[model samples]
Target: MARITKGILGGFSGKVGTIVGANWRGKDIIRSIPNPSNKPPSEKQMLQQMKFKLVVSFLRPLGSIQKKYFGLNSGSKSRINLAVSYTINEAVQIVADVPELIYNKILITKGDLTGFQDVAATPQAGNKIGLTWEDNTVQGNAAGTDRVTIVCYCRELGSFAVFEAAAERSALAAEVTLPTIYTGREMQVWAYLNTKEKNVACNSSYLGALTMI
Candidate 1:
């Protein structure tokens, strides 16, 4: 790859013969398009591709939250990119050549803001979830007005139930009733605290899976 500086075409995009021109991080660059390869992928390459696929599938749906809270963006890498990388490296497990997500290791949000303390989730009647946490409003970077967010993923339904601003940090507890479709299904729950304005957030806590009553 080579940066284009005052070229005749002035940083043109799209294909120009064998090389492709494009803008990256406010700079224009050109790189040769790789020749099509007929060779098969190696085992290691396949494994890596599988892991990447699994992580992308799970995280893409949560792109809005991840982009805002996953991590600080670096240069060309955005927060969503960082989330994908982290999930692939730290949250995926392989069994018999199949990549599976370790729910406990998954992070719905990651940031420096103070997180929940001793958070717990319990299944309640009528397919509701009762969430409780210790009062940590005075803890590091925490505030009584910080709002709580909940995320519940149902693998059986291949869907998620997200509740944003369900409560405030000082409230210490909240309840969310799942949709009728989620009745009798097991869900993996997570919770996090964010500023009332939703501009900042803390790392999310995985509150364990529970079967809806």
Candidate 2:
């Protein structure tokens, strides 16, 4: 029998304390080591970068797992589970100083076929509506001939910001697309956000959400 590497599912035991401590301390320490000119990264910059990297790393395994374990019809349950751990941690770490980080929130406002009508004039097989930040994309069920909009409610800020391209055609689903360069039972989308801007918040929804048609 061919040896099957369990991959992440093999359940490798990771050192929690070591990983956390090293990630937390190493990030700050390295940035503060100072450059030839003796200028060091600000504490805020360190924290932002660390948080962004951590979230992207966490998503690394999730994307592959999704392609392997779940397909378009599997719904969002598995993806949600994979994302929660990293999402919560990123949320906590980013807002450690500012309570608003924890308090400010995002949620799915609209779901189902009824809401879809409002977004699309003649909803068909490919149209969808949902909240997306930078990369986050969520698609609704195409049960009815209506446009669906998934609204995300942000607590600190009144009302949610709907994605501009929520109803646009999918770049991935178009027919004349080139053949996939690589084939895998699994895949993941990794993102690295620039965190140098002061007072600019990292968009947590960049990966976007998607569901079965």
The lDDT leader among the candidates is 1
Each model's lDDT: 0.90, 0.28
Error of 1 at 80 (Å): 0.7
Residue by residue across 20-108, what tens digits does model 2's lDDT show?
Answer: 11123123211232236567889877676676564544334334323222212233345444444435453444354532223223211
Model 2 score (lDDT):
0.28
TM-scores, in order shown?
0.93, 0.21
Task: Quote the positional error of residue 196 for candidate 2 in Å.
Answer: 41
For candidate 1, list the clashing residue pairs, or say none.
Answer: none
Clashes of each: 0, 19
What's the CA error at residue 130 for candidate 2, in Å?
A: 24
Q: What are the runs in model 1 whose C-alpha is more than 4 Å off?
A: 1-9
Compared to the true structure, candidate 2 yields what TM-score?
0.21
Candidate 2's C-alpha runs over 4 A off are 1-38, 65-95, 98-141, 144-213
